[model samples]
Target chain A: MIRVVAGFFIVMVMISAATVYSLKETTQQLKAHKQQLSADILKDRAAIKVLRAEMAYLSQPARLEKLSRRFLALSPARADQMAKSVTSIAGRENFKQVAFPVDEFPLLLPQEKPVFRKKTVIRQPRVRKAGFYDRISLKLEKNE
Target chain B: MRSADLHIEGAKSGALEVARTRLIVPVSLFVFGFSLLLVRLVSIGLFEDISDRVTRRASAKTEIIRERVDILDRNGVVMATNLPAPSLAVRPSLITDPQEVADRIVRLLPDLNRTRVLNKLTSSRHFLYIKRNLTPTQVWKINALGYPGLVLEQAEKRVYPQGRLASHVLGYVDMDNKPQAGVEKFFDDHLSNPERSNDPLYLSIDVRLQYIMREELERAMDKFSARAAAGIIMNVNSGEILAMTSLPDFDGNGAIDPLAPEMKNRNILEPYEMGSGFKTFTVAMALDSGSVKLTDEFDATKPLKVGRRTIHDDHAKKRFLNVPEIYTFSSNIGASLVIRQVGIEVQKDYLERFGLFDKPVIELTGLSRPILPTHWGEIQSMTVSYGHGIAVTPLNMVTAIASVINGGRLIPATLIRKNKGENITSSNDYPQVISPATSRKMRQLMRLAVEKGTGSFARVEGYRVGGKTGTAEKVVNGVYDRTRKITSFVGAFPMDRPQYIVFALFDEPHGTADTFNMATGGWVAAPVVGQVIRRIGPLLGVKPVMDVKTEYQNLILAGNEKK
Candidate 1:
């Protein structure tokens, strides 16, 4: 009986030691994950600053005016041309039919209706919660 | 023999018991020590791990390094930025042979003095700087030499890619990490402080508009053989300075070569007797004080003499002239008579109200105070009425004229950008300097000037430009030099609803055949202002008013009918 009691005590100490080792490993993994997230946040902040600057550069009035003149063949609206539609409102009905405002006539003209066709069915990706060691293994597999 | 045997057995047993006791004591002590060591190892491995992690994180996050902030234009165009560079340093204590390393370095960097490098390397300090701002290729070449005690440190150096395009506005930074001039000096604190995460300072300048003005001004400077030229375009409503160029400017990245004394910034720093531009102010003062109406007439047929000095118009109109005619003809005699009718005290008070007597307190440095008369007497007031015997910067004159045209509220000129769609009403805290009616009359009279007077060259079709021209002879050695003149033009565009005010001035402009050999304001400066307006108008979102009637025609017709 005394021999059995000694053997049981040794087994209990060994189990407790293994539990402590696993707990320490988990804590280290948590720290590394937190550090990676923080790094990602910093990178995202830098990218956002760059994107905003690029957007501002692209939206500059002088550049937009140049692009419009080149690509769209648009020019600054003449004052008399802007007043022509309004003056037509005070004129006869035949005049209105003959010279309808370009801005307002877009709605009156027949337009092609866009057909909404679904290509691939939308679905959410499957999310799996893996342990630290399993995540390492999965990452290795992806690398391979 | 039996008794002796029995005594030996007893002694042997006693020896065995003593040995057993000694062995037990040492074994117990060993067990205790092993357990204590195990406990200590467990404590360190598990409990102390959190604190160790925190220390590692703290050290990792502590980047106590200085980095330079970027300088951008209003539209976020990079004007000045700090690029990462390598600089050579030396660990003096480790340098066993200083002369050997210096000889090798001098070959790679010929600009460095061999003796100076040797002395710095042989110094007693742990570290010493040999040279700063080395290119990547130079750094690699020097490091490949494999000299002992040599080190390379990462550094940042400023670069301006636009070269001399916006030099005066986006000033240069020095080696000591200090801004020297222009917007660089104006917003130095904002640029230096890293903790300021507020949006980067935005200027009201447009780079394209700045390019146009600088290009045109350069052409005029070359064409007219002028000593120096300065131009400014301001949004009359918001007091935003769109473009300001002072020629003979240096590149922000290049070494500042010496400049001539007269080629300084004549817009804000050098005050000049802005000849006839002061007529607008005189007319505004007379109209605001109710001393003279737009219909009031003055005798400008001959030169008017006051206190042994005669004030003459460049183009003599020997007839009774209305207020519009006086401004259109740029009649100094008529303007002097108008000031006399308003009296000296009122004229002085009006000038002070227009911010002409004080230094221009804007975002820029190097502002010079206006040279006002020491004592306000009849002769002083009369000559000052037509912009003589007093000197003020072109910026001051433009701001004053902007206030006169933009509904008579004096808004201080600002380089700071305003938010889009925000209300930009003039500052109402100050008293109204002139009534709306007087402001309208002044605009009409200025329009008349551009239509049929000295400012005729300033006209742009369908833009309705209005302005006054000034050609003041530079006072040399206390006597006005008739040949050396400072010609300038101050004008506003789309006069029916005035939007922008443009002013251009040429210092000591010589006569050229293209100008009909006449280096007057109307011939030289007015055309530059007109070109600046035409180029910058589209960039500033100011469209030409094609349908609006020309107000100049009606004003001229009214004046002619009265005659």
Candidate 2:
């Protein structure tokens, strides 16, 4: 009976030791996984910072100005090309029609010629020069 | 049989007693230790709390140590940033072959002297830096060498992504992460403190406007072969400096040339006489004090003698001039006469009220004081009226102009970006420098000056540009040098409701064909202001209303003012 009790005690201790070992192993694995995830997040944050800086550098005004000079033949948008409101135009019928910038005083002189497409209106924003003056145009269909 | 059984039982009981004595203490201690171990395991394994605690502690220790806040423009563009740049260092004790390591390092980094690296490798010191600010490519190359001694330790580098665009304003940072000049120096503490460094610092500058103004100044500098140029664009209502630049500026990333002196911002640091630019203040003072009216006339038949120095207009309008004519023609005699009508006491008070006496309080450091006259006499006042005797920085002049044009409230110029929800309107309790009526009149006169007078070149086709031109001969050894002129123009656009102030000045600009051998303010500076207004107007959301003539028909005095 003493021999049997000793055997049972040895088996119970062995089982508990094995459970503890497996538990410790899982904890270590989980710790390692968390560390790796944290490292990835840190790396991603660094990449985002670098990309933001790169975007700003690429969009610098000097570079854009140079590219504009090389590619586009258009000059700086003069004051005459802009109007205070839509009514400043000749008529409602000509609103959708292409508004050509006259050589001088486009607002004062009668429409000499159409310089743009009838489907789109060319308007330069008065604030912030993001500087993509290209063939890309947004199609806006006015509700009748 | 009973006696034999009794003998066995007695033996068994004796044996049991011996066993109990031998094992009881040892078994109890073993059970206690095992129970403690199991409890600890359960706490760690099931709860999983200790790991989180360790992570929080580790992150707190490593990540929250120190960091520098980024500097941004008004539109949230990153102008300056701090990035972790790991640098190569070596443990001399661990280096097996100094010569071999030095040779490889030299091959990878040609700029790093082989001799220096060899010396560092052979030095008695345990650790020494091989190179700083190593690019990722360089780091990769160095790491590939696989020397046990060579290690990369993380360090930070401050970068200005905009390069020379706002070099003077952003200034430069030292290797120690200390800001040496500009906004960096201005808000050093706020940016460097670990507690407050997370939020980015926003400046009032608009990088787009800054680029436009700087380009225009560069063109003027190259075209006229000028020594230097300074320009500024300010929001008249908010006192926000949208753009400011000094020519010969250096890139913030590189070593600044000491000989060039281009890094020195002339706008805020150097004070000039500001010449006829002061005439605007004089005329405005007269109008504000109710000493002069729009129809009031002054005789500008000859140069007025003040003490030994005679104040003369270069292009003298030799006739009786009204208040508008005095400003339009930029008549020094007329300005001096207006000062007399307004009296010297009121002139000093007005100038003092304009914050011309004190140093300009701005975000940037190294601001110079306005050179006030030692003796406030009649001659000083007269010369100061036409902007010669008293000297003030271009920033102060522009700030004062903004106050005059922006509804008569003297708002101190700011470099920090104001939030959208922040109150931008001037306080009712803020002291009124000039009446709203006087402000309107001043705006009209400025427009008329651009229209009919010396500032005609600044007149855009549709935009009603209002401003004054100042051409002051640089003083050489206490005497005015006729050859070298500092010509400047300070103007605001759409004078009916002025929104922005543009000031352009060039130092010692030579005569060009376009300027007709006259390196005057109207010739050089006025055209720069016009170019800037034309290009930047659309970008700033300012719509140029057509019919400038009929709109300001009463204000337009001359026909050539028409575009």
DockQ values, each candidate = 0.06, 0.22
Q: Please, what are the lDDT tens digits per residue for candidate 1 over residues B1-563?
A: 65325433565888866676667755875687589679969987885556755655654452343545666566656556666567889998887777888888899999999889888988888898888889879988988988768898877676665556567777778876688777778888888887753346667776666777777888999998888888888887777887778887777766664364432566788898999999999999999999998778899878888889988889886777888888898889999999999999899898988899988757877789999878888988989999999999988998899889988977678777666553268456444678878888788878878878999998876577889999999999989999999999998987877889999899889888777789999999899888777665655555466555544455556766765
lDDT of each: 0.77, 0.82
Model 2 misplaced stretches (Cα beyond 4 Å): A1-36, A71-76, A93-144, B1-65, B257-260, B421-423, B548-563
Q: Report the TM-score of candidate 1, chain A only.
A: 0.49
Worst 10 residues of 1 chain B by lDDT: B2-11
Give the best candidate by lDDT: 2
Q: How high is the lDDT of residue A81 in model 2?
A: 79
lDDT of 2 by residue, B1-563 (tens): 64324433565888976776567656876897799789978976885556655564455334433668888888877899878788889999999998999999999999988888899999999888988899999999988999999999888888889999999888888878888889989899888877776588989999889999999999999999999999999987777888989988998777666446887899998888888889999999999898988778788778878678777877776667777878888889999999999999999999988889988767899998999889988988888999987888899999999889887888878888876555268557355788888888889888878887899999887788899999888989988899998999999987989999999999999998867899999999999999999888877768787665522334334322421
- Residue B241 lDDT, candidate 1, scale 0-100: 81
lDDT value for candidate 1?
Answer: 0.77
Candidate 1: true contacts recovered, fraction: 0.00
